[model samples]
Target chain A: MSKTLAIGPFNDAERAALSDEFSPVFLAKPDELAGLTDDQRAAATAVAYKGHHAFGAAQMDLLPNVGIVANFGVGYDAIDVHAAAARSIKVTNTPDVLNDDVADLAVAMLLMQCREMEQASAWARSGNWKSKGEYRLNRKASGGTVGIVGLGRIGREIADRLAAFKMDIHYFARSEKTTPGWQYHGDPVSLARAVDFLVIALVGGKDTENFVSAEVIEALGPRGVVVNISRGSTVDEAALLDALENGKIAGAGLDVFLNEPAIDDRFYKLDNVVIQPHQGSGTVETRAAMAKLQRDNIAAHHAGKALLTPVN
Target chain B: MSKTLAIGPFNDAERAALSDEFSPVFLAKPDELAGLTDDQRAAATAVAYKGHHAFGAAQMDLLPNVGIVANFGVGYDAIDVHAAAARSIKVTNTPDVLNDDVADLAVAMLLMQCREMEQASAWARSGNWKSKGEYRLNRKASGGTVGIVGLGRIGREIADRLAAFKMDIHYFARSEKTTPGWQYHGDPVSLARAVDFLVIALVGGKDTENFVSAEVIEALGPRGVVVNISRGSTVDEAALLDALENGKIAGAGLDVFLNEPAIDDRFYKLDNVVIQPHQGSGTVETRAAMAKLQRDNIAAHHAGKALLTPVN
Candidate 1:
């Protein structure tokens, strides 16, 4: 009578480690677990969801005896915490480990847009190295205003890096914060007006829906650059496009989108912007740490200890 | 009789400042003024060349009585120092002033490519914000090896910035020299092999022609990136293109180019590279300082004092 566990889409190392500890039931899809024995299924203690899509309400029915749902990464929006709570099951996420990695990326994107590193590389690749030529200088990132939409862990990390560059840091939070060297703005519109570079680091919640709109973009003005490392739904996509096309805003650096892996053609044509495949916490080091944290959370739960990042 | 000074293209401030001291003689092309009277030209103590194209030996015949050729920027490749020296006319360049600005750009470019900042921005601009998704942490600049191709004033400034990022700094120089926290490599390939990121800060000289080639790019490997803040001729364009296309190197960030205002389509398509229109010293503060240096050089030379940056 070994304790049963379910896992899928976990990294090879994490999957193998979990199998060694419990009576593992590996399911390829949420809908394909109908063939499991009733007694084995009833013994399930933990389940892991590693995919990008939501583990819908229907999928939860397959793991009736599961007491814990351990999420692989910091972003647990795909998991229905409310539904999990109703069953008295503990919902856990891996956070804090990805802060430095994601913040490093935020600063990188800001410097790229300001300095135009890509266009310079193209010239070097073309064998056109001339001593005297017409070369336009990209904007400088130092000594400029940087506005953070959210002042959470990632936003605070970004501020620390920008402080190294001697940039004036500002933030728009739900309420006023008393952080030193950081000025507080009541809303996004005020933040946009106060800063040259606007960074979105707010969480993806109902209250934060469409936080950056056409009005906010316009308020940022022609020399402003917006960097979004948060949820894509926080911005009004149509308004951003209009702002970029009309030169109402200088440029942008975005890591997340409203819908992913299905990019639009408009992004391909613009030289003023930089694009990545939404990789905020996609580094090998960060991912491994995340997987290890999830493993630790499960091990602790079984020992009857407090979970590392438990959802209340 | 008025002191007639031959003036080439100068900034508005330089032109306005010189109006009080001498009668300015503006020339579209230096060679066009070859037929000027000896008495008229004898008063021409200074000549400026501001065009993109270099003034060769043929153009030197026009400035028979010129005492000094004050360049506006740090680079003096356009006005041959050897040609000016032969006629006993002093040549001066504005250096040191542009080092911080260029170094600022060099680091900005390096961060952009490594962080994939441009790609993130494009995701925001395309109405397909949902498709780009969240940032995946790529790599960190701190605790990495930074290889400098040249160890001049700008190279040193870049080294200082790398120190702030906690990166180990190495440099390739024409001759062996010792600098604290910097190890020198005799050749470009050795430097490329030892570094996670190679920064080109060498001057455009005969000794540095095609210094970075296929062999160098190959040595850098897939995890390494090359940053060119120097002239484009320092790198072998074909070799770099092949290396980038074949994934021999991770990515590149460049500021100078082989050709002016003309870039290849291949680099435009690559996701790893970051490009700019050759703007190393384009900041308003640095440009103004450079102009003042040029003016001071002219004033010092007229007073029979040693020029600040004289071409020996």
Candidate 2:
């Protein structure tokens, strides 16, 4: 008998493409698994989510024969990897494919904040057109300092984009990287002091929890701008608020927050900051490419080919 | 027996520099001529205004010995050249020194508007950070069409900058000239249809009055952006307002306006536009350079040498 794979928050194209090779069963609802017989459920091998929160390991428990949970994004934090590991079900995440797109946003945020483009636009709209005098011209990105907190794939790509602007690049990494044109610092504090724009690209975990605190923010000085593209847990939310309120740091461009969808109201009132919802890899072109990579990874794993991006 | 020069509205540094060369009579007000005796006023050889709105030629005739009106900036439209010519007074303007600075602003405005950096920042600050998830990714400037109106010194410099972005460049001029890397269009309407970004670099005058009308704007289509660094008279305000309101054109970035220091309030409400208070060459570094060039032009004329930028 052929193995059955449960699929979907239902991407029609991904489902059709997968059905060409496997006997695919479309799971429309979480409760529908209760109706499946033991033997039928045991025949399922792989599962994918069409919706944001559908593809967790607990959902995989409905299918006894499930071997892999391939996620459609670089972030698989929502997936309980430990639960899958206990069940001997492999979890795969799409990475590196979305690096350029996220890096483009990071640089865009930095430029927007430093240049004060938002405030300038507001001033233009306010009937102060004739009275609107010259704006405060900040230092250009070209030949300026740019510091990165993490030296991972995305962080490195951000460095490469800033390099095109002729910026001096620096990074804080656990170990020294021999990349040309990048100065590696021992810690985040040291990195903040050395640069005018500090970008946070570190992974979220116990070691990186609250890595950017009041001390590090203070070290960035009054004219520095902080851009966080990583998880909100890596930064001290209260300290950032205090620093921003007191003008300890010049401004910030945040893509992630401590309590997303319930962000602090103070960040909204400040004209100096730039904020975006966690859209690091949210571009249509980049997301589609990521989904395809995830699909290919599952197919390659089942065929016993070398996995594209293996975590464990 | 030394000739005097009336210096109006110059900064301290410019005044000090002029004091070294001539017997400088600082004109505190337009009516300050009343302070001078007939012989003292008659000894004046030249008059200068740092900013626009210098007195008319009627005031210049008060000083019968005056030979030139050396303006600080490139634009002398406020100065009545016909009246100066009637009294046989040569007029000189400082140009070429401000081309690169103004061109830099024009490009920066274009990039900021297309990227929607202002709107993104506002959304972030409005406590709707999650809405940023829906931001439309910007089209790359590389391999895009750039249209230049008034192919002069600054327009050419804008073309030079666009070369780095890998844009296909075209221009609309009164007469065609053989310039490599630029295809010349016969008129503004044709240029509007040919490019994604239409940049206004034409001078403001009767010859070029309302050069960008409703017809030209209508031809630009919905995805087009207008970047104006030239005088406001080059564009019809009513046509621009109509296009912006109806979404016929995507957006605009304007530095000069029809009635400057008295801008319309409607421009303030649009998220698609960027407005500056006529600060094209307002940078401290660039302004200092401009002042030095103006002084050099005056000294060159005084020495009976060729004027640096004589009004033809």
lDDT, candidate 2, B1-312, per-residue tens:
446565566666678877887757787555677778888788777676565554567677787887777877777776778888888877788787777667766777876676565665555555555553345544443346989998898888777766545578999988986677588999889999999899999876666789999899988889889999998888988899888988999999888887766777677667677787776765555667667777766677678788777784
- Candidate 2 residues lying further than 4 Å off, grouped into runs, are A1-108, A131-143, A148-191, A200-216, A230-237, A279-312, B1-108, B129-194, B201-216, B264-271, B280-312
lDDT of 2 by residue, A173-254 (tens): 9999979858999988999999999999887645688999888999999988999988787899899988898999999988
DockQ for each model? 0.29, 0.25
Q: How does candidate 2 score on lDDT?
A: 0.74
Residues B206-311 of candidate 1: C-alpha lDDT, one tens digit per residue: 6677888889888898988988988878898878878888898988987766755465557667788777667788765676677677777777877878888877
TM-score of each: 0.76, 0.72
True lDDT of residue B312, candidate 1? 58
Per-residue error (Å), model 1, residue B245: 7.1
